[model samples]
Target: MAKYDYDLFVIGAGSGGVRAARLAAMAGAKVLVAEEHRVGGTCVIRGCVPKKFMVYASEYAHHFKMAEGYGWTVGESSFDWPRFIAEKDKEIARLSGIYVRNLQNAGAELVHGRATLLDAHTVEVAGRGRVTADKILVAPGARPWMPVELPGIEHAITSNEAFHLEELPKRIVIAGGGYIALEFAGIFNGLGVETTLVHRGPNVLRGFDDDIRAHIAEEMDKRGIKVILGAQHAAIEKTDTGLVSRFTDGHHCESDVVMFALGRAPYVDGLGLEAAGVELDEDGAVRVDDYSRTNVENIWAVGDVTNRINLTPVAIREGHAFADTEFNNKPTTFDHDMVASAVFSQPPIGSVGLSEAEARHRLGKVDVYLARFRPMKYALTGYSERCLVKLVVEAATEKVVGCHVVGPDAPEIIQLAAVAMKMGVTKTQWDSTCAVHPTLAEELVTLREKYVPQGLGQAA
Candidate 1:
């Protein structure tokens, strides 16, 4: 018999924590999982799943426009915020039920409440008292963070509130240049709201490749979404009509809504990790080693709380690794390299591996191949939106180091590229693969020319 009451106790029933708990339980360890909010955590409950539904809803407005060029007489249409919200709520509730059922099927007991570590192996629930475990896993995840300096900041809604708006605003002012902010801007604009994106940085998507950042901004402009660069919200005021935002650069805009998708921070407060001797990094993320183990031997953390890779899939992998290492005696660890990601923006973005700039700086003497063209669907509709395909290669070894795509189905295409890159597929190998005719991805394998440095092959 085990010395502790439970072999494993998991905090936060998000993707990471839930996976760890279920797997540990299946391994025949007595496991208990606690969640204060919804069982599915950020991605399933409030983040990716719900947000992607909004993205799909927003895209219909564009479809109606494109349908005209294709000779489809689409009748006048209207979008009801309440109807969509209700449907989304139903779908979310169903998913939450599935998550709970899965855990139960795996023989893991679910406890509902905010759980805090009382010591290394003891966790105290808000009303449920204490539970002792041989090992503990913390996957508390992150929360949307907002700026505090602006006055009337409380009036500004974060992404969480954006999902449940009573009515769609006529005009919206969104602050932040990250993926979340840009995505919402597209969402509101596509839904017929006057959307204006304001960023303190010179451009949106600060960490992406320069070309991608500029291209997305251009596309947003073409869609009539105003982009304000190098400025921030100085203050906000509630007027009789709605809300008004004053920028740091002396510009002001009035709108029915103001949202800040600035970023997210690890939800560590009140978790009692400090009391349990688990250390956090400078950014307040739970500090974990390569194996996702905290300073305390029995306590481990995964997902956004660890601040490794904030994606939901990454968290799932981390959780699976934890169970394999501790229970199955497999000694597994998650490899963060060559992971692919996508942004569900107006056109969307999908990328993997190093950025072009990062590759150039690190490898030096890199070769670049890029192509821009309209997809066949766009051509028939007379739509002008174009797609970009780029490949960055190490010139010396001919190994493809990075792949970036901006256009329709980009996320799906990049997933294939990610698999190839993980296997160290070279530029030559990519070229040898037969191109799938009449497909957007064909452009990726068909690029014959490499972009050369301007001065290198010239008169000099």
Candidate 2:
């Protein structure tokens, strides 16, 4: 064989790349992974890990208020934004070190610099020597997208800035109708920001089940988050006090800062895929097959770079499948149907399998069971917030085709269903099981009235 510097050359040290690099090395392939920034990638450093920490911090404010109801006194419910940010930063730094250690222990040499493809078999580092490998993997991940049409757009920040804000702004406006915008708005609002969420669509989280979206909208409004629907941003001008954002509907809302949860784009700007003979989707995402192999031979791509589902776990699965099929030679294929995901908005949302609407469209008949009521803790706080659980089953097969929930602890509750749905669980199995009494999750089995319908929204 002709001489090569490494057996496998991996680009982007994000979730997918790290996993691929470590596993390829463990499989006895000489591996070298190049990362421009940190080894842990966006999820560990900037995205999910840090974002969830902020969510937890924002949640404590409500927990402190609820403490009064549980007969425990929460004196001086004050928060230090700087302290929280520092603590979160510490957690990220600690986790990032672990990722680097794992890569080294697995025998993958981790290089720190920007890597550009010189050819299909050769890559050049910004200031280092050329690396020639038998196979290459790209897992560049994704970054947030912002709009420029709005005048004075410099005031807006994405989720990256949302986490590291030095001092929490007293007033803020969040744009976009997606989960990121919704979740951040909830975190900021819960932390006592005079917050408004503006969405161009009729509602936020539009792709989720309609019932959950509607109930969540009601809950968001109840929580004092002003929702401006069917509106687009025209401009954001800085003023002496804060910022004023004009809406396309000829209205204006003023806030100290503006954020766009608009959307995310694949991080493929400098990855020389064109020269490597790799194909990409119109949105700049590297298109891969079931095995995560790009169009070019011996080259593969995975994770948010592919724009397939754009969730952390999905990226992890893609990486594992790519390593198994490409390096390990086990040749595994993944079936991505019936994926489950959770959105951590104020009244959180969790969904799995076909939506109620989707089930009716294809199967035409569905049995939907819905449970809605005040959770036990809400009675103590006098909050009057309600919880909902919806189940959609195939009428003919009695298989649970979909599961949806919108409420407090919805993410925790729906995770159980997510696993069960992945196993192709049936409604009979769900009902035949005994219920755990008095807990919110037990509502999944205690739903009253077996719903049967074929109407537009009767599924829910």
On lDDT, the leading prediction is 1
Model 2 residue runs over 4 Å out of place are 452-460
Model 2 over residues 157-251: C-alpha lDDT tens digits?
88888888879999999998888888888899999999999998987787788778888888899888999999989988888998999999999
Which whole-number lDDT from 0 to 100 does residue 67 have in model 1? 88
Among the numbered candidates, top TM-score falls to: 1
> What TM-score number comes out for model 1?
0.98
Residues 1-460, model 1: lDDT tens digits: 6689899999999999999999999999999999999999999888999999999999999999998888999998999999999999999999999999999999999999999998999999977899899999999899999888679998999999999999999999999999999899999999999999999998999778777888889888987899999999989999999898999999999999999999999999999998999999999999999889999999999999988889999999999999999999999999999999898887899999888889988998788888878888787677778888889999899999999999999999999999999999999999999999999999999998986545557221
Error of 2 at 211 (Å): 0.6
In order, the Cα lDDT scores of the candidates are 0.92, 0.86
Clashes of each: 0, 0
Runs in model 1 deviating more than 4 A are 453-460
Q: How many backbone clashes does candidate 1 have?
A: 0
